[model samples]
Target: MTRRIEQGVERGSRITIFVDGAPVAAFAGETLATALIASGRIAFRRDGRAALRGLFCNMGTCSECFVQTAVPGRAPRRLRACLTPVADGMAIETGAGPDG
Candidate 1:
């Protein structure tokens, strides 16, 4: 299970983001990877070879944390979970499926 840093630090406003139809609690200004990791979802996607991929180079140089996201009326798009900030109502899918 993924765990959050217990620094006893105050966080920004909390928001809900959907991951594979399940709701995950996230704080504003935090990256999707951070939220996922805190929520015990370490694997962001699976490669063509079926290898699980998660955060690697967090500075966007590597695309290991890519995830598919979709909003109402808009086509699904891919973004790096480590670089993309979490937004309220964001829908994400993680895996080597048609959506991701």
Candidate 2:
């Protein structure tokens, strides 16, 4: 099931992004956190105790939505998925990050 409400919201152009080497469909203008949650992902990262973490604030304040992302020419780095927009061909790795 998808978390996105398709009733009133107009969908953007379809784009594909890789999450943990798996393909996930998303809209062009949506945030990585949006796409990930819409794709039925529950855990964004693992805490020090191996507990799962997911989107909390949905904003940039809490760092619960952290993930590692890498583009064509960019090195993999930890980023707040809620603040980063999804891009075509963007690769994401969940259950990871500096905190995990």
Candidate 3:
């Protein structure tokens, strides 16, 4: 199920979470923030200085939209929530800055 956002596929459905070594259910078609917020898992990211940040802008351009995804055959990578479409079993990690 997708929300009508001016001809854009912007919504998701119920899904799951992989954070801090645990699995949680997340809403499909929902942004990571939307799902996390619904599940009260809102510490979306940590800044370079280790400051916590959540979905501030809710758009693809913000650094706060970062999420780590478990891509098959490739190393895990950071994806922007505002731009990525959520999958049924997508694994996401929250509140960690990129490794230096």
Candidate 2: residue 84 lDDT (0-100): 98
Summarize candidate 1's per-residue lDDT along 2-73 as a digit string, tens digits: 376659878789899999888999999999989988987778888898888888888898998999886777
- What lDDT tens digits, residue by residue, belong to model 3 across residues 1-100? 4232437555455466665446766666666666656555667777788877777777777677687776567787887766675566677777554431
> What lDDT does the true structure give each of the candidates?
0.85, 0.86, 0.64
- Score residue 64 of candidate 2 by CA lDDT: 84
Cand. 3 TM to true fold: 0.66
Model 2 bad stretches (over 4 Å):
71-75, 96-100
RMSD to the hidden true structure, all candidates: 3.1, 3.5, 6.7
lDDT string for model 2 (8-76, tens) is 888789999998888999999999998988887868987789788999998899998899875668887
- Global lDDT for candidate 3? 0.64
Location of the lowest summed lDDT over 10 successive residues in candidate 3: 1-10
* TM per prediction: 0.84, 0.84, 0.66
Clashing pairs in 2: none
State the displacement of the C-alpha of residue 59, model 2, in Å, after optimal TM-score superposition: 1.0
If candidate 2 were superposed on the true structure by all CA atoms, what would the RMSD be? 3.5
**What number of clashing residue pairs does each candidate have, in the order they appear?**
0, 0, 10
List the candidates ranked by lDDT, beginning with the highest. 2, 1, 3
Per-residue lDDT of 44 in model 2 = 93
Report residue 51 deviation for candidate 1 (angstroms).
2.3
